[model samples]
Target: MALALNDKVLTEVYGPSTGTALRIKQVAMVVLGIAVLAIAAKIKVPVPGSPVAMNMGTFAVLTIGAAYGPRLGLTTILGYMIVGMLGFDIFQSSTADLNGINYMMGSTGGYLVGYVLATLALGFAARAGWDRSMGKMALAMLLGNVIIYLPGVAWLGVLYGFDQPILQWGLTPFLIGDALKLALAALLLPAIWKLVGDARK
Candidate 1:
């Protein structure tokens, strides 16, 4: 389906859109988004050679951005970061013993920064109606992953020295997982839009 460039985001389409109701809906979405991020962070599998675990946190970030649009996407990610910064175990490698700023400054620090950029990128792509097409959504998801990994790999190099196998450590190991997520989001978002379109009819 060819959604208009100005089409509403998923959140906008389902919720109250005026005054007090809109504010309440936005607040509720932010809360729910944070919860989803936290839960996804914990659902991880170890990568044999990489310090960063394979996790669904990035998938949650991408989906939230595409569904929530820029304003709310940014808000939700910032809220999640703030909670993690406050010593909450709301990150992939975070824990009670190694939580807060200290943990954030570890190897995962750059990826954390990339999360903000990726969210904004996906949110804007969704706003432009890219999320309504499987091809466009896949491209958008690919771009979002690149946005994330650029800062992430760069940070790894800086933190661990350029001589280190930064790509192997930070980028290569995650490709298969990220590609899987990209494909899934691409398929899922367009399908959801189809459902919404059918429901409206």
Candidate 2:
């Protein structure tokens, strides 16, 4: 009986050990996710007139959230921001231009801040197990993207002045591209989760 009890205890503990191992693997994966996001942010697909560029960082963000859930997703994005602020050429620009704190607070700053919030939103959805369904995942990503856009547009208006022409230049032109990005992220996140799940199984 004692031996049987010991075996049962070991079985219970085994799941916890596996959980710990999974968490460790998740941390490493999140770090990799951050690096990929930084690279994606820098690779601009040209869109005319608007400062809006095709950034695939959103895809990485969603993937991280879907795979690891919320806390790690937020941490990974914050880590990316810290690295970029500390003179890493991880921003949209390829060159390392760390002039001052203001550099971090410049025009696209809100978008950077939004990355965290957006990840949190998606992460929460994913934690609720929405990562398996493409439609639900798409909605989650769409909402996440909106979270980014609201603050981004608000900051643009405040910094660049609340003029109609500024809205035209800053916000309007990028809508289509942002929509496409949302669609892409929606498509990619569930697929990534499937690949990870299959690998683990």
Candidate 3:
């Protein structure tokens, strides 16, 4: 259940190489993860009253983490967040349309923050080799979603206060979508692994 330092999906697919080569590949993967996340952020459905948009961002988060493993995955997540903070329009429409620190102060900020935590939680799970199988990855993805939602709900509750219920503003609207995303991820990760396996043979 533990991933050796080099036991990540990409590492498995490509096989081990010199430290320099690995470093180069890791950097490239991080950049690619950021790009994919930016694209995922754009695919969204606006939820009324609530600042949080339903987006594929979470799916990209867990998928990237599972692919990149803990260390590189964390680097990529933090990079994505920071770049958005620098006004890259990297967030979903709700926040991407926003500028500077204002977006973080927006209703969607908590969820964005949740993306960071969720990526870490799932990345760690990936480091534990959870990505190698569908069931374990499903659990890892569900847990990752929880990690995203908790801070999201808390931040939403604090920002809006008692004026709106946190569930309405943040949590309740996205449950089904998140479930669907999780199921898709469960299948996707193992399929990618299988493809990689087939390629190497």
Candidate 4:
């Protein structure tokens, strides 16, 4: 069956049930999630024909969303953005010298917004047990990417004029990278579920 009707998520499977311990776990998870997002953002590789580099940030974002579920996922993502807004070098294109509000309002702003949307999408999907199977998880990840790309491409078109090759600039270059990340997430999530299952046996 799906999720066993308990509403349990990956994090909750191994986490405390309630009380101060649960609160502490959630807060600590948010902190760790922020750290993961920051590290992923910085680990960028230049795309050969694209202005934007391919980064692991999306992968981390989707994984976090699936693992943490909607509420914690949203909290973690918001916290990450808050950290970036506070002038931290924790976004894909931000740095110590060129961070904060102005930087967030730049070209990549739409994708940042998309991260929140995709997280909720994936989180809800995971809570519904989509993350339990490889095929379903892959589909869920694909949906999340589409959610991310729509706003991202739209923002690029708006920011740089629709006359510009917005799809070429913001979409196509990352398709290959995103595909790889999607496959990784698909495989990784199901595999983790297996581990979780096996651990209890």
Top candidate on lDDT is 1
* Poorest 10 consecutive residues by lDDT, candidate 4: 1-10
Clashing pairs in 2: none
Off by over 4 Å in 2: 1-23, 98-100, 192-201
Q: Which model, 1 or 3, shows the larger TM-score?
A: 1
The estimated TM-scores of all candidates read 0.95, 0.78, 0.88, 0.94
Give the count of colliding residue pairs in each prediction. 0, 0, 0, 0
lDDT of 2 by residue, 100-150 (tens): 245557777767777888878777777665665789878887888788777
For each candidate, what is the lDDT? 0.91, 0.67, 0.81, 0.89
**When superposed on Cα atoms, how far off is each prediction in RMSD?**
2.5, 8.2, 2.7, 2.3
Task: In model 2, state the lDDT of residue 21.
Answer: 76
Which is superior by lDDT, 3 or 4?
Answer: 4
**Candidate 3 global CA lDDT score:** 0.81
Give candidate 4 regions above 4 Å deviation.
1-6, 198-201
Ten residues in a row with the worst lDDT in model 2?
Answer: 2-11
- The model with the greater lDDT, 2 or 4, is 4
| lDDT ranking, best first | 1, 4, 3, 2
Q: Give lDDT for model 4.
A: 0.89
- Candidate 4 local Cα displacement, residue 124, angstroms: 0.1
Error of 2 at 6 (Å): 29
